[model samples]
Target: MPAITVDDVLVLPRLPRLDPAATAYRPVRRLITAPSGYEGEGFPVRRAFAGVPMPELDPFIHLDQMGEVDYAPGEPKGTSWHPHRGFETVTYIIDGIFDHQDSNGGGGTITNGDTQWMTAGSGLLHIEAPPEHLVMSGGLFHGLQLWVNLPRVAKMSAPRYQDIRGKESALLTTPDGGALLRIIAGEIAGHRGPGSTHTPITITHVTVQPGAEVDLPWRADFNALVYVLGGKGTVGTERRPVHTGQLAVHGPGDALRFAADERQDSHTPQLDLYIMGGRPIREPLAHYGPFVMNTRDELIKAFEDYEAGRLGTVPAARVPHSHGQQPPR
Candidate 1:
C-alpha cells in the first residue's frame, strides 16, 4: 500500500491502438431509457436495463441510477430494512453520503467516489439511507447501484462486504489528457480497480472532454454496455448518439469507442459515462423483487427463512465504518 498520487493517473498505460479495419466487433444494438420510479421511503430512482429480464445481461441483473437531485432539508429518503439473496449489490457513490447497516453487522458510509460491494450470499437484512446528519441538513444525493448475479453454487455462501475508498480506485487520464476514467472494479489502460468481484466485471466512471476520444477494450465474450450520466456522446463505430439518462446496449465487440461531440452546448463541454461489462452467468434466474435464485422453490425458501427471523435485523446502533478485506492482487 504505497501512497497513491496524481502522477499515478497521468502515467498509466495507454489503450491499445487496434486496427480499425481488422476490428471484429462493433455493433450498437438497442438504446434503453430508464423510466423514473420510487424505491424505499419514496427515494427517487431511474431503472436502467434489466428492469424486466434480458438474459444477455446475465450475471448482471439490474441497474438503478439514484438521485442526482438536490435534497431539501428533511427531504432525503432511502430504503428501509430489506433482504437480498443469490447475488451481490454494488453501490458506487458519486455526489452524496449513503449510509448502510446490515444483519451481519456490516455497515459503512459511502461518500463521493467511494464504493460498497456487498455479497448478499445466503441471506441478509440491510438498510441504506442518507446519513442522519445529511438527512437533517440535506444536500445532494447521487450514485449508481448494480446487481451482479452469483452462480448457483455460490448463491448460498456466507455474506461479505467490501468498502473501497475513492482514492483506492485507479484514476487515469487519456494520453492526450482529454479524457478521464476512474476504474472502480475493472481494468482500463492497465490500471485495475480496488473493488473485488466474484464474477468477472468491469465498472468504469468516465468523463470525456468535448471532441476528445477514449477507447476501452473488453473480452469478446463479455456483455458490454454504457450508461450516460451527463452530456452526450457517440458510441462504437456506428456513431450512435446517446444522451444523458440513456443506456447504450452494445453488441459483442472487442472494444468500446466513445467521444463527446464538439457541437454541443457550452454549458456541457464534457460527457460522463459509466461503462460496464462482464462474463455472463448463462443460468436461468427465478427473480422476485429482491431475491434471485435458480428455482422457484429456492426463492420460496428464501422468503420463509426471512419471515422466520433467519435473516438478521438492521442494527439499532450505527456502525459508521466497516472496512472489508482486500482481494488478493
Candidate 2:
C-alpha cells in the first residue's frame, strides 16, 4: 500500500491539536464487514459500502476495493465497456496499474497513487483494464473505485474527466506525527485536494503506526465513514474493534478519532484507512445498476438510452480490453 510515503511525517503540516475536552468526536453508529466478490471479468473486489443505508451515504453511492492480490501472467482482468449516467466514478490506484477511456474523452493509465476521476453526467460509455504489458506480466494489483452521486441539476451536465496523480495529493500529519494523511479531495482545515467535485466531499487515506492515535477535525455538516483497508484497529470514541474490510459509519460530530493496535500481523504492519465525508444531497434517489437518478422513470430512461445507443459506443481505436469483452446486455 505504498501509494505515497514520507520519510518524516514531521515535515508535513500538522493537524490542529484540538482540546479533547471541547472536541465533539463522532460516535460509531454502525460497523459492517465487506463481503468479497468478483467484479468485471473475474477480478476480485470487496464491496465497501455493503449493507449501509443510502440516506447515510448520500452524495456518495458505491465503493469497491479491488484486489490486493498478486496476479500471475495473463491473469489480470478488467471491466468491459459500460455506461453510467448521473454520477461520477473516482478510481484511485493504491498499488497497481489501470487504464481507462471513456466516450467523453477522459482517461489514461493510472498507477500507484493515481486517481481517475470520470464524470458520467448525462451519460457515457467507458472501459477499464490493465495495460497490455501488465496483462502479459501480471503483478500486484490493488485499488478503490468510489461512486459519487451528482446533484439533479448537474446530472445532465456535460461529462468530463480529471487525471490526478498521487504526488498531487495534499499531505498532512497528526499532531504527534503518529499518522500520515493524504487528502485526495475536498477541504480539510484550510487545506484542499486537487479533485474538482460537483458535490462537496472529502476523501482521505490515512496510515497509522502501531500504538498510535489520530484526531481529525471534520465538517459538522458532512456525514462520515471510515473503512479499514488492512491491519487491525479500534475506531470511534467508543473504540469499537475494526479490522480489514470493515467500515465504520459515524454519527454527527466535529471530529473523527481512531487508533492502531500495538500489535499487528507482519503482513500488515500499519493500520490503513480510507475515510470519506460529504455534505448530504438528501434527494430522492432511484438507482439501478450503473444509473443513479432521482426517479424510477429516469432510471428506466437511462437504460433505454444505453440500449438505443444514446449513452455511447465503444471507440474503434481503443486498446484491447480483457478477453475482448463487450457491454453486458
Candidate 3:
C-alpha cells in the first residue's frame, strides 16, 4: 500500500454533548482589532489579522473580517502585494465579491457565498481586492479569513489552492426548525464537508434558532473554539451570553453542547457561529508581519529570498476591489 496522507486518517469525531459545568469550560479570549496603519496607495482600509496577539489559541493563528461595506458606484477598496509562509488561509465571503491573485499562478474572483483556501507552504505572495459593481451599489460586504498553522513537516511543501463554491458545500438542517449547519471542511450530523484540508481539523458554520439546542461531538486531543458571528447561546451549561465578534474557547473534551433559549417565540434569536478546532502543533512559532515559520532562521531566510527577487511567481493581475475595502476586525 502507498503511504497514507493525513487526510486518510482524518475522520470526523462523533458528536456528543458535554456538561459545561461538569466538563470545565475555559475562558474564551477576546481579540481586539487595531488599525493596520499601512502606508501605501494599495493598502486599502486599515487591515488586521487576529492571529498575532491571540497566539495562545495555538494551531489557529488569525481570524480576520473584511467588511460589511456599502460601496458607491465605481469605487474599489482592497489590498495588494502580501506574502505568507507556513500556514493556510481560508476565506469565506458572505456577501460581495473578491478578486484574488497569488504567486502560485492562481488568480480568480470569488463572489458572495464563496470560500477560498490557500496554503502558503514554503512561501507565497498574494493580493485580495474588491470589485467595482458592489462598491458602486454600496452593497453589504462581509466575510471572514482564518489562518491555520502548518505542521513542521509540511512547512516547506508546495503551495496549493482549493476554491469551494457555496452550492457545492454540504448543509445540514436540524430536525428542530430554523437551525442549519454548513460544513466546509469537517463533518456534522454524519454528513461531511467537501473541501480538501492539509491538517486534521473541523470547520463548520452553524446557525441555531431560538428555543433550539444542538450538541456536537469532537476530539479531546484537539483544541476547540466557537466564534459567535451573531445571536446568543450557551455552550455546555455555562449559559454565557455570546455576541457578534466574540470568540469562546472551550476546554479539551469529547463533545460540545449548545442550547438556545426555549421561552422566546415571537423573535427566534439566531445564532450564527463557526465551530473550529484542530490538533495542536505545540512547536515554536516564529511569526513576523504576514509570514509564519517554525524557526528564526527560516523567517530570516524568507525575507532574504523575497528581497533577492528569488520568489518571483506571481498570479495574473486581477480586478481591483472585487470584495470590498474594510479590513479584518
Candidate 4:
C-alpha cells in the first residue's frame, strides 16, 4: 500500500481506480422504512439491497437506510435478536446512542461518531437497541447499516466483533478546505482507518463543501459506488444533482472528482457522500433471506440445522422468532 500525505495526513491505496462511468447512478431499487420503537415517530429504514435479490456487490450485499431521527427519552424500540450466517454487518452511527448485545456474551454501547463491525462467519445471534436515556430525552439518531459478503473460504470462520469509536477512526481533511474524509476501512487522502477487514476494499465518508473539489483514486478492477447521505453534488464530469437517500453507481474509473455547485444558496454548500468499493468475488452466490451461502442445498441444510438446534452454537442466545421465520422463497 502506497501512502500519500496531505497536510500531515496519510492516505493509502487498497485498490486501483475502476471506470466510474461504466455504470451510472441507479436509484435505490428497493426501499423499506420500518418504524423502530426506540426512535420517536417515523423512523424510516430504507433497504437498498438484500439476500438473493442482489447476490453480491463485489463482496457487498446491502446498504440500508441513512437514518436521521429524534428519539423521545426512555423509549425502548430497537432491533431484537436475529441470526445471520456467512456475512458481516456494519453499523455506522452518526448521532445518538446505539447499544447492542450478542449471543457471544458480548454487549456494549456506541455513542455518536462510533462504528460497530460484526462478522457472522458461520452464524451468530444479536440484538441492537438505542440507549434508554437518549431515546427518552429526544435527541437526533442517525446511522447506516451495511452488509458485506464473505468469500466461500471465509464463510465458516469464527464470528467476531470490532467496535470503533468515531474520534479514533482515521480522518483526512482535504487541502481545498472543502472535504472532511473519514477513512473507515481503507485509506483516503493520507489517513488510514483502524478497522481490519476481510477483503480488499475502501470505504470513505466524505463531506464536500460548496464549489470545492477533490480527486479520489480507486482501482480499475474493483467495483465502486457513491452514496449520497445529504445535500447534492456532482460526481466525475456529470453535472447532475444528487440528493439524500439516493445512491450513485459508478463504473470502473481511475479517479472520482466531486464538485458542488457554488451558486445555490438554498443548497447547503456541502455534500455528504459515502464512497465504497471492493474486489468483486467471481463466485456463485446462493442466498435465501438472511443467510448467504454457495448452494441451495447448503441453504436447506442451514435451515434444518437451525430447526434441529445445531446452528445456534455461536451466539448462544436463541431468538424467539427464529423458528417461525421461514427462509425466503
Q: Which candidate number has the best lDDT?
A: 2
What would the per-residue lDDT of candidate 4 be over residues 32-151, giving only the tens digit for each residue?
Answer: 223222211235565544322343366778776546656555542465556778888888877676787676665578876677898888876666766656555767667878888888
- True-structure Cα RMSD, model 4: 6.5
- Please give, for residues 1-329, the per-residue lDDT of candidate 1 as tens digits: 01123444457545566667777655787788889887777777888884434666777888888877889998887776779989999888888888887899887888888888899999998778787788789898888898899999899999999998988888777767777777899776577998788888888888887898776777787888899877888988778888888888888778888899986666445788888888888887899988999999999999999889897776778533222322100
As for candidate 2, its clashing pairs are: none
TM-score for predicted model 1 compared with the true structure: 0.91
* Cα TM-score per model: 0.91, 0.98, 0.79, 0.79
lDDT of 2 by residue, 1-329 (tens): 89999899999998999899999999999999999988888889999999999988898999999989999999998998889999999999988899999987778999998999999999999889999999999999999999999999999999999999999999999889999999999988888999999989999999999999999999999999999999999998889999999999999999999999999999889999999999999999999888999999999999999999998887877956766655531
Q: What is the Cα-based lDDT of residue 20 in candidate 1? A: 70
lDDT of 4 at 245: 61
Model 2, stretches more than 4 Å misplaced? Answer: 324-329
- All models: lDDT? 0.79, 0.92, 0.66, 0.65
lDDT of 1: 0.79
Stretches of model 4 off by over 4 angstroms after superposition: 1-42, 49-56, 74-76, 263-269, 313-329
lDDT pick, better of 2 and 4: 2
Q: What is the lDDT of candidate 2?
A: 0.92
RMSD of 2: 1.3
